[model samples]
Target: MQNNRIRLLMLFITLLLPGIAMAASNAKENYGYYCVQCHGMKGNGMGLNIKDMSVQPRDHTDAKAMGARSDDEIFKVIKEGGQSISKSVLMPPWGDTFSDEEIHDLVKYLRSLCNCKLGG
Candidate 1:
């Protein structure tokens, strides 16, 4: 009976491991919570705050431009804010708010949105 219970528990964990991992991935949730408002959910640069800003956010869907930029540049922008690269002061840094892993995953999400690889 004890061995059967342990086996059942192990099977349950194996089946749920993927779901648990996916939940922990948290890229979509993080992006939606932190970036969608400012960068737009579709990544078209027309976010909620665009109307109140001088410079528009870079559209992640802009394949041409986004492809031109390196991932490191994107990472830097996220880490240092727009002002670091003279983009916009309104774009505050999220480096302090997020982990490096989160930022990297966000970058991958941006790439997926654009449908273009870096420097492509």
Candidate 2:
């Protein structure tokens, strides 16, 4: 009985470990569904169609660049579009397309990818 309990605990840890470290939800999928052409899967600003455009997409992993912006700034950019924030106009306003809550989730999801916070 004691051995069985220990084995079950080990199994539980094995199963639960992956879930605890699971990456944030759907950011990859969202990139595929919407941002792949310009932002790229890695957010390196080197997406497939980026070369033909006048302005390059923001590099999500560029800690130095993204660090200066605040959550509100990022939020506004995502909701109202980048042009409103003086970024490339290619970033279309998602304000009409998704709810405020959805936009918040997107912001969190993006932050996760960059391993960056708005101020960090």
Candidate 3:
């Protein structure tokens, strides 16, 4: 019985692990498709368009900077565009393109970039 239980637990974990991994992977893909041009693959704000833009993109990897903002603020900016938060209009609205769940996932991914957590 003990051996069977151990095997069952292992099987359960193996099944659960892929979903967690796939969520992260999907978030990365979303970031690459929509944000990499301005945020860069490394989230360093050194994207291809850096030279042309009047305002520098926020560095997602900047822990101190990213940590200052709340998750709701991040979500608002992503969904409604930076202008919604009185930021640069260069950050276009993605509300039309992505669902709220997807935007939340992106926010989570951005937080991961800086190793930061949203405060309550």
Candidate 4:
């Protein structure tokens, strides 16, 4: 009985460990997977596409610029795409790609990168 209980506990821990690790890395993982190509790994506007594109992507680490926008605005752009905010058509919509929770998490992660809040 003791051995069985130990084995079950071990199995539970093994299963739960991966989820915990994934949860912690979720924002970064999502950002890397989707945003990094255009936003860059460091959140700078100088992505690989910079040489190929006309308008530059927003630098996520720019506190001054990022501070002017509201969280709702950022969230909207992320969900509905830049065209929804009249910014650019290049920014594709991720509403179909990511869940609301994931979008919110990305917003929060952006805030962290900029070291600024939504509003002044």
Best by TM-score: 3
Q: What is the per-residue lDDT of model 1 for residues 1-120, given as tens digits with 9 covering 90 to 100?
A: 999999999999999998756644676788788887878988888789888887888898999999998899888899889888878887789999988988888788788889999887
- Which scores better on TM-score, 1 or 3? 3
Relative to the unseen true structure, what is the C-alpha lDDT of residue 81 in candidate 3, on a scale of 0 to 100? 96
Candidate 2, residues 3-103, lDDT tens digits: the string is: 99999999999998875444335445555677768888777788998879998888877776777777787789988998889988889887887667666
- The true-versus-predicted C-alpha distance at residue 111 of model 3, in Å, is 1.1
Task: Return the TM-score for each candidate structure.
Answer: 0.78, 0.72, 0.86, 0.80
lDDT of each: 0.85, 0.76, 0.92, 0.89
List model 3 lDDT by residue over 9-56, tens digit each.
999999999988887888899999989899888999999998999999
All predictions: root-mean-square deviation over Cα?
4.5, 4.6, 2.2, 4.4
lDDT of 3: 0.92
The alpha-carbon deviation from the true structure for residue 22 of candidate 2, after best TM-score superposition, in angstroms, is 11
lDDT of 4 by residue, 34-93 (tens): 998889989988778878877899999999999998888999999999999999888989
lDDT of predicted model 1: 0.85
How does model 2 fare in lDDT? 0.76
Regions of candidate 3 where Cα sits further than 4 Å from its true position: 1-12
List residue ranges in candidate 4 displaced over 4 A: 1-24
- The local lDDT score (0 to 100) that residue 112 gets in candidate 1 is 82
